[model samples]
Target: MAEEEISQISAGEFEAVSQLLSSSESLQLAFIIMILGIIGIVFGYRKFSSWVGSQKFYYKRPHFSRFVRRAVLPFFAIALITAINVHTQTGVLFGEISSIEDETISAHEQFAKILNTFNILVIGYTISHLVPIILTKREKSILEKEDFDAWFELRGFSDDSEDLFHKLYKWVPPNNAPEDIDEKEFQELLNTEKGRQYLEQFRTSKGNPIGGYEKLVDNPFEEWKKSERAKYEKYYQNCITGNNQSGRKLKPGTKPDEIFPIDVWREEKREHGYESLIPSSRPPGYAKKKREGLPKSAKQILPLGIFLATILAVVAWWGVDLIVLATATGGFSIGLGLALQETMQNYFAYIMIRKDKIFVEGDRVQLETGYNGYVHKITPRVTYIRDALNESIAVIPTRQLVNAQIVNYTKENKLVPAVVKVGVSYLNNPRQVASILVKVGKRGMREIVDTRGRHLVKQKRCPYLDKNKPSCGCDKELHVDATQPVVRFNEFNDSSLDFSMWLYVRDYGAQFKTKTDLRMIMYEEFKKYDIRIPWPIRTVYQGDEKKEFEEISELDPDRDKVIDEFGMGDIGRGEGDE
Candidate 1:
């Protein structure tokens, strides 16, 4: 792949392209026409290219053409494609529209239309991230198994765990020296420059005090665990779902109680009330509520807001396009705008979203329209996302981010763990998988599962496992070796099945690369062992020919004949087959 990329495109190819554009008659005519009419399309591209050049992307180099197309195409394409779809659906299928309105496309289609606009915005946001900037890809080598394991445990771009507690702060109280040396002599060791340097990288990142610092921030995790109210809040906040383990839906307003004393919690939900009409899910219709308006995650006046946003975007582009083009030739009529109202609306919404930071570069966002991943870039009205699969980046409208439940792991904190939940067939050992996963994850991330942090999670009764929930695998789901680790079988799925366990890793910075490597390991292991990773399959038989079958069968007959002739011992003789 690397070779193909380098060999296919080079300075020579670029020069050829330039020469073709400059000398070709069609290109020359096109240039002349563009210079006379729609000059903004030409000059505006250059201006935007210049503007883009000023912004620095750490890694990727954005080409002028890529910049121009991404920026301008949305302003035009959104309105144009939307117009085509709407015009066709409205005019030609006028009769069928009413008949098929309910089921043919359903409410989801209309929602899809709205989402398409928003998806464009998401695409625009993602493009920025794809434009790589400066990156430090320095590698640290570890030879010893323990060192490698330690590196794995702390692979995340985070501080060492102990250093957080053992922050070497100021006012170094001299260490007690031997009776012959005395305390003053030991103070010199504390004053060394080397000791101060050690404190900065390890101590500061861990939020520790430098130079024998005594200041200690109160333990937030411990504090939360102690308070009765805190425990209940956490129980609900850290609620485990079957998607991660069990597929069972906890009773609405479910809280820890029957297992633990009710008094243990300061307050638990008494009524199964839906907290928000909107669900945290990215898809629009996925909201938990059955209501008229949009999901709570969506801006309150969802559909209307989307419609209005569309109009605004169309206006911005249409107006600018009209004014700019008019200066060179003629203006577009108001009738054009009216005729393309819905199209314009979608375009307008697209721009409005891109202008706002509803989601931007590096934000991990899931759009209402099915696009989900880290925002790679935002240009004009479309945003791009490097989807979770990391296969190909998806482009969506910025409006989609606004309309979707934008889950920003980095917005608040950068340490987001890309979770991998494993579910196996009946009677399969989950403990083994868990151990394998931990080892695999640590190896990939060079980080460790914070066993020390394990003690922090002390629940009276583990909510992860229950017999009644369907999410909990059938009675067959077994977690026999969980005598120590907080591992459990929570639920079942169609193909294989589910285990949920919270792993403490370095943090978010290490998460992407770590998870990627771990997933690769999983794929290799699965393939090597002939394990079937669940996926949809369909078999197509191109009418087998009896003649073909007979011909092949005749060639293999000697195998069965050999077996018949010499019993099982004949198998050893069938090695070389030309």
Candidate 2:
């Protein structure tokens, strides 16, 4: 029986070969078509890639063009496979051909299915890459247009969506409705579908859909009350947690029970709320309200979207049951989690740092561990700080930075406070010394501020009168009452009276120069005033000086000669020389 079955299979294979030999012409034509199609696909892909690379949008985003180019090969492969299958099945390419056996047809179908699955994977991957690029481009367009409403809509806010509930059930006047329409006419117009659709685009200040009437459906000022309450809540929480977004802690002796007025909290938040990655060209107090904005949000969401799509595609194409897939996914996830625990922690910390506006690039920060520097760059895992003291880049892990105490000297204002300590003799009057210190501080402040102001005017960046002018009285405009130089009598030391001269410089970088200027000025002023800066003086009493002199004479025979040459005859005497 086995021999008979084998002989039958062999006979079937021989018959299939004979049929192929009978249609050599069709086979050659099919082979020629495939070869030409492949050649055309290759040439077309290169041209398309070049064209895409040349376009302005893709030129700016080379990665997007690369992704597009990578997708071309798989796309052409699918197209070629489809063309071959169609010509084989329909015989339209030749218009006359020998019949293909069921076995051959079945094999082709199986092969096509496998290729199609692979094509789907490639297409899905391409889509994943393109989604972020598209989103980024859209965000850039909206930003360039300065269309905040479109941005809000892209973020899925209700301000851009139609209020279905108000449109159907409520009847109120749209905020933007024609003022000419009377109550009666407006009501009549609302009965029509066109009027309703037209009015649907407008909304009341409270975010309700505007209807036929001119009045709002809800209390117009209720939203303001809710907004104020929310602000107060956040302010209260921030105060309690000491997370003021500036990375500064509350001053010592601050009353925990003291709650600032909502207005004060609102103003504070308004001042410190937004941080720009680069310096803005806008005027001061023009709050940006958004940081990296929609582009960053899209970048964050795209990764997760890609991850979920990949898992779905795997399950769909591989025909794996959900239960087995879930089990394998769980084990894989556990292993990945364990391996990337520290990395994930740092990434999340980086997110927190960015969201909270703790500190940004170019901010001068002093860590509790004595690492003081300007933040050069911030990455997912590490923050690079150019050390101010050593002029070296310090790489700190994001997780460690988030947990460490940081003093952001340039957060609220660029002006940094500098102190110059001076010690004067007790004979000098404290009031006189204080006056001299204040004069020195004021001199230093004027010199530095004038120099900086002149530089700004040269650069046409002075915020005073005419920016283009060489000097527009910027000194008066730049001066702040709070930053005026002051003198503090801090403490009394053994040698002299300690006093600190405090003044503000233009920025953290200017503080060192300002301090040096103050010290030099103070030195000259003290000398002119005859104010003595006393040094520590010690008095020593020697008992039995004659015996001490005898021991010295025994140790060195040339003691008398050295004393005669140096005129030190009084060294063994009781008289003291200081």
Candidate 3:
């Protein structure tokens, strides 16, 4: 009975197919239009794909070319569909088709509208994909033009060292579990209590319980499934699959855990120890100059924004109702805004920082919060600062930088003035002390200019020299009078006359050393001239010296007994005593 019912249903479908084939001329015309539309779609796709493939840059990236071609195919299909719909309506209007079913025309129009909507989504996706690529290309061009050769070279060294480290220290499972047990099966087993019990039986090669398995058992599954664990699991899977294997082979006697000289060197390089050792490789002020020369972040962001806006415009043109879109997004927009309030503020602050030229990378700045450092990097949300006093990095929100007071030492000029104060005895000749102070200041200035001046000139950081002609001999005048050391007897203290010697150094980083040099020079010159730096001296007098002694002796009867114990017969005798 079931077989007979199926046969009846098949017959009905076959009769329907036959009826469609023998339908009116209008139906046949619609069928022909669809077939032609499909053909046009195929032809248009081929032409578009070929054009994309012919472009030199796009041709090199076949995957990207294919993605772009696939993305654009929906638009081509929609256009052909629209054409077919237009032709069909024209036929009906002119009576070329004696009659057409309203439902049939309606279905065709609906299908075309759906394709148009799909095409809008495809366009939006294509623009989103292209924006990053455009920004990356612009950034690469900008970096290429700037002097980041040292930074790039350092990065290359780091990558190579990391590669070498991985090779030297190959990762193995905690325990040498049966090689036959698939990692995937082991992970799946972890989900079940019985499976976990089974895994707990296997011991590590070291003859100890599996540490990782123990950790898994201790922590709740949900907590263990957080992002950090997920990342570790992914990394472990990659390691097990040999995806992270470096092709380099080990030396004849090298163990997997062996530390090599190259590894040590790489570690030092990572810590910037190598850069410090080879100062000539990295020009002074390289970070500062590179930051100054970098194209503004706006240059990268503005074009991407415009491109996205154009995509939105195309979506709007495709008959997406703005009122509906706004209403649908209103709640989502409010939630997102609340969630990203701090993020938005930071981004705006980053724009302000760049626009106002408040500070750049390598500028030594002290924030109102007493965070002093050189700006290492500037991102939309966070600014990384390398501490001036140590190797630590301070991560400051960009908004903090905008809202807080900052003292930027390298904003307008690299040269910064430093003062050294000294106190001389009041009896010492003020003019002579002043002369020695000025002399030491002059000597310190010469020493700095001679030692660091050449480097500053090379870095184009010399304040006295023209940036265009760094070797114009104009800097030589700085040694004589351009920025001569100034001396002022600024204060008079109770014990001494305080004098301040003011001098200028190349930059903030040099100020400390410069001050030290000047102090050492002053010490030597002061000793040579027999100038005394005084200390507090106090002299106290009581009523009269003899009377005070007599009163103290009378007050203390033990004084005579103390003198007799020391075998002194006469105690407290004066000059007139007999």
Candidate 4:
């Protein structure tokens, strides 16, 4: 597949196209066109020639002037040849074509043969014209991936260069220094160059004290997670559906304790007793109570008037041409199909949204296409989502939302279950690993709200006067079972013993932060226990010679350097330098 793509990219017009025209005259014309193309490539050398030398395909030199001369000029040249050949055959340049049959005339018949060759040349020209565009677009896509891979690999390396925490900050406190040092000793340390350096480090990057390096990699994965969390938080705050603590409001003058709570009805009963339920005013058919506008007989004839107007329109349309009628009918059918297709889909999607409770405003939802965001708004046609991954607004068609598998983080409850997976060396005891996980999980539990055993509090408190009424108890409360953090040994892979643990948190906003804390704590605990997070281990058996197995670094600086040189590194270098 790789070789085929390379071959396609390298393939070009000038030499390969000479065989497309068979006749001597047509062949000569094709040869002339090839020469012109060669001339264009030669003159545009400074613009695009550098692209040809690299072993990897050059998609295109994006200069409009160069592209026009190389890609567009050949098509024009072939078109001109075809036009002249057609004119020579029929002698109809800037004039009407002859209606008389010409196959009987020998000269006209021979001219027709030349015209056919020109047609072949024109088709060949069109193919040649399309090849560069198709190849260039595909090549550009591949190059973008290559550029991303290089950037991803270099992110940590570049961050290390900027990070002062490991290089200097960690040394500032001085190992085993006496905490009870006198003022004289403190002053002496302050006067030293190390103290000044420590102070200067604090001033760097606008008083960013620890200098762990501000997010050097613009990773989509991290951005997506952030956006998802932001969406969840927005939903958690604004959504009327789940975990709302505020109570619903009641209308004015309504009695809370009554079966029928309307104050007006109660007032009427108080004034007139049981007779209030029966109207005391004039009946519907009475002169004063009757509707004052159109006569009943005219109202009955209104439908006949509408039906006659429709019949007249049909009679007028019947007098139009059959061709016109057919065309109009076909066009209307097509237009109706196009409009109704989208409309019907949206209609069904709306039904699904309400039926399945797909999502509501402020709910964090991820589409099947991997676009996850807090639903900012749901309109008749499109659903607007505030993307969690990038903090951007994603407007998706309601129709598309119906087909997609929307993963709503806040669907079940505000608390999203989080899991941390780690693999330790096989040498470590399973029980020991489980114990460490529980310890880290407990540590992670600190400052994070545990949703387990938490219940959704009603938005409004019921009126005490109506406490015995069913309407007062209409508010539903949901309770979740209290769960302990669980650790499970999942799989024994080729390299390590994989284990996963589950933790519950109340706020989806703090989910990632909690995970990070757990991982960091686990790392420290693992180090203390002398348990290694193992790399993939492979064993190769040799027949005679004994070979030592060594772990290799994941990154190759030399390979990366070459790829970066060919990529958009120059553009990124300015930003990196800043």
Candidate 5:
């Protein structure tokens, strides 16, 4: 397209198209073909597209559809642009009277046309690529064939080559005991309708349906011999024939049991031997039916193709109109202004957060506003998080999440060894108490402790720090400037020495469970040692100390020195009431 545009046609590429046009005599006809070439691009593309739509490529891989959309747009664009380029760059033929310079105008016009064609090709490929995907179809490949195979192997059926009918012998257990079969598995086979349908199709196609001895019997040469003797006769004949080996030449001393008879694998019993090659030959669909497993089908890629085509159509007409309208008049771009405000904010913040890579789903995150929760689902617009209690969920906008201070409990790593604190008697050994608390924490949530994470978590590297060593969850990270409670001795109580000890936690949600375990372990461990938690104490005083009479009480008793305590001061004598 570029070569054709700006009259920048390469000599070889021009010659290739020019040679074909020269063979035709009519210049007018040649010009029309160029027009049709532009038109044929549309037609050929539709034909190619119709062919593409017929194919079922993405039937199984419905999830990975965005890649198809991204690929398809570019392909259509390139094909259209190339066709237009081939048409325009090879200038339409003029009569012999025309000079090369006379043809320059048509060349320039075609060049402009090619340039404009390509410009339309690539308008907004990126926005549609990054947009949230909502495909037309939504079917999961639930009944994968392998799940069925595992289910079937649980049953007595072997692989395809082992049908077992040839070596079939029903075990005539000494007392005719009942056979054991799983009802759940039998029910599952019947329940899987799609699998059953596929199996029926496969069986019909192969002209077999897992036939048993009775189903295959049809009739005997002697239907007249319908007695019990016939049953025993057929059974014994097959059994003894396998053991006898009448066809093979044998040495005189070699007995049937000693000669490794095929009938009885264990030489102790020379009975009818059976091998399992028939079941292995069973069609793959048979196993699937037996196990209630079904083969996966591909997703409909054409729906995505049609959807992208509509997006392109809208983008071309509406997008070009908007741009052209604004460009023609000096109108303000209200849409651009509104779009940029939100888009730019999200774009920059998404970059920063992605670059930082601090938190992920399932982490307990606390906002600066005191909204604390477990990260449930993170969408582009909002993040849904369950509160620390796990009862209520909070929807945090991207703007708030990006602007606010966020802390993750399982940020660095999981298996966060947490501690429990109690204000017990000062006599208690804080070290033993810490040990017991840690033990309780380990045993309490050992089952629920999740270890699935990046390699860094397992390796215990930087960023995924070990909080217990020097860092603790109770305190805000030292690097962060946030309100954190440093150690404080708030009071001195009566029965026990009061102090606050902040401890670590794996997550805030686990706070309740860890607290319970800690209280239990502390109670159990503190019983061995006499550690008591004290309550607040208050003291009582009898007399009012607001006014003092201490100096008058020390004075030697004299009629002149005696003083009153009721309305008393350290004064001499009062004669009048005033």
Candidate 6:
């Protein structure tokens, strides 16, 4: 089209056209044509503007208004200006005002024709390329409408809310709304101020419906089973399987489905995929398995590659002498040997860790050296322990961990066994002491009181609840119910009966507080019962006669004076020591 325009516009034709346009009548005609084009652009913009939105159907299509404003209208406007310029300047749009050698009116006219050809090409290209694209996009909007209607039908949308649906389609909810909305949920959501704000956002921003939202029409269990059956069938057909060690093969008379059911076949197929030499081997449409993190080798590979590259680059760039190269090679060999040694040691530690099922990350552990902390991370090189007492991280080499004994507080369970040892004077009855210890251990004084208060409140709120019901008929058992404290006599000390009371606590970190509380409670109980914790009694033998001190008390005010008069310190002094 552009070439034809250029070829037809000869020197005579260009002069005639320019002369005709130069006239006021011809200028007015050109202005009318431009005005008509502008009107056409406005109408086109308005016709397509309604469908443009953040919604998928509208979003897929280019905005008609933008194309008109940016491309169509601008092109016509420029063409109008070009025509006017040719009329006034003897057909040359960019003609120089200064008189130049070999510059002719015909040359200027030819230049105008060439410029017009470029404009024609651009306009023609837009028509040929852009029109079909825009036209094809019209189907998306139609399809969206059809889907919307179909969804309402499937979901049994009330006909009474037809007006509301129409309004929603015409104007989207506010931008802050969920892209996919159920009308009932939308209504309920709009009851709140936040939801109202969201709706307003959806409306303002022209939020789109979620893609395929309407298509998710069924989710029945039987239908799901059917779908799963079909999926398994596809998997069995495509995926390979191996015979069982039992040599169980379908007999000639037996049906394959009966001998090896679809469910069993599916499981076998899955196991095959997992045990395959190729990790990526999977049945068609199967979801890709997700890895929690990068493999150890993968993590190490990048750094190792960089290190090797750096060594090579340094050697090449420096152009080191033969002696230097030999020296470097020796150093490299030594370093490699050391690295291999460390790597082997770490690998052994890793094997030990796995084989023993030792404390994993997150377990509270106390190392043999009395370093108590949570296992933060376990890697081949080192195990990171986060020490709560010191509020710092302790990095212990894996080799050291493998050699040392570790007390895993919460390895098997979060609950940790805790003991509080107490000694009371022999004057107190052993049976009574043990009973008191058991009582205190079973129900921690303050903790028991709080638990009772909570239970009372719960029972009061729901009066129909059975008082005898364990854990109030809930699946969860209370921590108090789970850990019944036990008391046992440890040993008889010189002046007191030693006993240890044991109980379990949920958090391993709570051991200290629990011990403190239990001890305090036992002390109060002992004081109430007048059960004394006896001080040590001393007997002195002088001149082959033994003198026994009865009911000796450390709190006795005159004890220090008595000790001084006896000269016990001098008597206990080492021989020949001044």
For TM-score, the strongest prediction is 2
lDDT of 5 by residue, 1-578 (tens): 32233243223223323443443455436446556654665566555545443333322132343445445545555555555555545553332213223353353343434345444444334333433233322211222233223222222222222433222222111121113324454345445764333322221112222322232344321221232223233333343344333433222112121221111111111111111221112222332243231211123334455457755454453334434433533334555667678766755565555568656666777778787778776554566778866689887665567877787777664433333445654444333333333334333333222223211111111121222121111222223321111122335456454444332333455445555654675576445433455444544645454332343223223211212211112122267643
Model 5, position 23: C-alpha lDDT score? 36
In model 3, where do residues sit more than 4 Å from their true spots?
Answer: 1-318, 376-386, 391-397, 449-482, 535-578
lDDT of each: 0.38, 0.55, 0.53, 0.47, 0.39, 0.48
RMSD of 6: 29.4
TM-score each candidate: 0.28, 0.46, 0.44, 0.30, 0.35, 0.33
Pick by lDDT: 5 or 6, better one: 6
Q: What is the lDDT of residue 508 in candidate 3?
A: 82
Q: Return the top candidate by lDDT.
A: 2
What candidate 4 gets wrong by more than 4 Å, as runs, is 1-348, 351-356, 448-478, 507-509, 536-578
For 490-546, candidate 2 gives per-residue lDDT tens digits of 798876798887765556776676677677888887776566786766436455756
What is candidate 2's CA lDDT for residue 128?
74
* Tens digit per residue, CA lDDT, model 3, 527-555: 76566787666445344656544543452
Lowest lDDT 10-mer window, candidate 3?
Answer: 251-260
On a 0 to 1 TM-score scale, where does candidate 3 land against the true structure?
Answer: 0.44
RMSDs, each prediction? 30.3, 23.6, 27.1, 34.2, 28.8, 29.4
lDDT of 1 by residue, 1-578 (tens): 43444334323222333333343354345334433443444466566655553332200222333444455634543444454446445554233323222344343244234335444553444343223211101111111223323322222102223433233222344345434333564455447765333322222212222234343445422322233233333343332232212333333222221111122111111111101111112222222222222212222224345455555454353233433433433223465777876556556665666456455566776655666577776654455788767898886654444556666655543333355555554333333444444434333332222322111111122222221111111111122222122234567665555654333322344444544555676666444323334443333546455654454345344334433432321112356732
Candidate 5 lands at a TM-score of: 0.35
Model 4 per-residue lDDT at 296: 31
